[model samples]
Target: MRQHSTSTHLAQKSSWTHPIYTKKQILDVQTAHRKASSWQDRVALSTVKVLRWGMDFVTGYGTYSPISISVPKTRTMTEQKWLTRFIFLESVAGVPGMVAGMLRHLKSIRMMRRDHGWIETLLEEAYNERMHLLTFLKLAEPTWTMRCMVLGAQWVFFSGFSLAYLISPQICHRFVGYLEEEAVITYSKAIKDFDDGHLPLWEKLEAPEMAIKYWQMPENNRCMRSLLLYVRADEANHRDVNHTLGNLNQTDPNPFAAKPKIEIGLPQLQQNGRVKD
Candidate 1:
């Protein structure tokens, strides 16, 4: 029999803890995030996406911030509920600045900018990747509260990272864009490994801590994971905007290191030893 690393705690978590959830449960989360029967929910979700995009771009760096910053994270039951519920925000945020791209793309779709067609598709692709984080967190964190911390830490990281861009758009944005692209790839592959049922203890730590945990973990694969892919894809969309602006960074002279390969629907754990939603 295969030596299941989680065998010891798996039953423990399954009994009182929520089942790790199969793909279906994960998909339910995706559906909750994407679809809204009520216009209010739809409007709220869209508003949240757009607003966070603006705030993150204006401040967040699309990278992990240090723990020293004031990010408003707290420890409480309500906080825990919010942690699990709001985790979707962080997952969607893997591709920092993506919602802005979509909004921008939509704004210019009629203008017929030179890169309009590909650029819009770029943002849409990135948006899809941003949504993958909901499932990847299972591998990254054991509890919902930790998930919020992970999400908040990314915000803090991006807060600092964006400062570089704010200070010097020409040089800093260029370098930062490249860094975000790398983050995209790195985080995407992270989704894959985490989802594959590796490293539970490490994941239980908060996002701020996971930043280091990710660094400590041995390389299980070359990719950043599906979650990160969404991140990079979004950055790619953001970069596409640079070419259109009358700015120094029209495009990376070096171009992408490797063509982005995005895949959806990775295998997930079965619930109750049977694959049923």
Candidate 2:
């Protein structure tokens, strides 16, 4: 077989393929979202922040910190190679780093005085993230089934919330910001590199919506050419909620506005990788 190039592979697309966006495309979207902000728009944001940070910290949940992760583990093989890849890369690098911090946050919930409602609400969501992570593990390890853990990451998006809750919800959004914006590179590479051009039946369901919604919009903005455009959008929304809440404390809101543009390059596949826009 001829050696296929990464650029050639990414550029090659079928008729049904989705549009891809670049860093500039995302900045354009930011320009649009920037104008839509208002004081009244901040109400829900302030409530979420205050509840997440203030009352929840002081009265509701308890004092919380961040989560942490464990060391990488030795792996056993399975019929599905991709699952092993997911486990090795995502579970090891992706989760442990983010989740360790979230664990600390969970432990912090113990410091709270209780008396506040929404503990169940919080737990339910937390449970959802756990479930998603479990599914992620399944996807990564493929000890049982087949699926791209990239899709799993999308479905397991609640990991963002877990991150948020792990830290003071106020500042937690800062971490959420990382997941939303920075994480795309991880998932994007997963999609780009893992596409061996074959997927099993059950794997189809894992991250169907993400594959469709993120990539298949009418705006001609997706092509899987760049993952940061859409993934960063996800981070922006999480931060928007938090930034708006900053208004209550008279702190400067609108974080991404000033956030120095993080450059989006090509997939860092290996020592052989080259930067692409």
The global C-alpha lDDT for each of the candidates, from Candidate 1 onward, is 0.35, 0.34
Stretches of model 2 off by over 4 angstroms after superposition: 1-125, 140-169, 194-277
Counted clashes in each candidate structure: 26, 15
Off by over 4 Å in 1: 1-93, 109-115, 138-144, 150-177, 180-277
lDDT over C-alpha atoms for residue 203 of model 1? 44
Candidate 2, residue 102: Cα displacement in angstroms equals: 11
Instruction: Please write out the lDDT profile of model 1 over residues 1-277, one tens digit for every residue.
Output: 0111222221211111111223332222211112333443344345445545654443222322234323243311122232343244444344434533443455456665543233444344344444334334433343555556556766765674355434443443233233333333434433433554332433443322222132222233223332233333444444443322212232322122122311111121121221121
Per-residue lDDT, model 1, residue 201, is 37
| lDDT (Cα, tens digit) per residue for candidate 2, span 3-41 | 212222232333333335445665554421222144433
Count clashing residue pairs in model 1: 26
Cα deviation of 2, candidate 1, in Å = 18
The CA lDDT at 201 in model 2 is 28
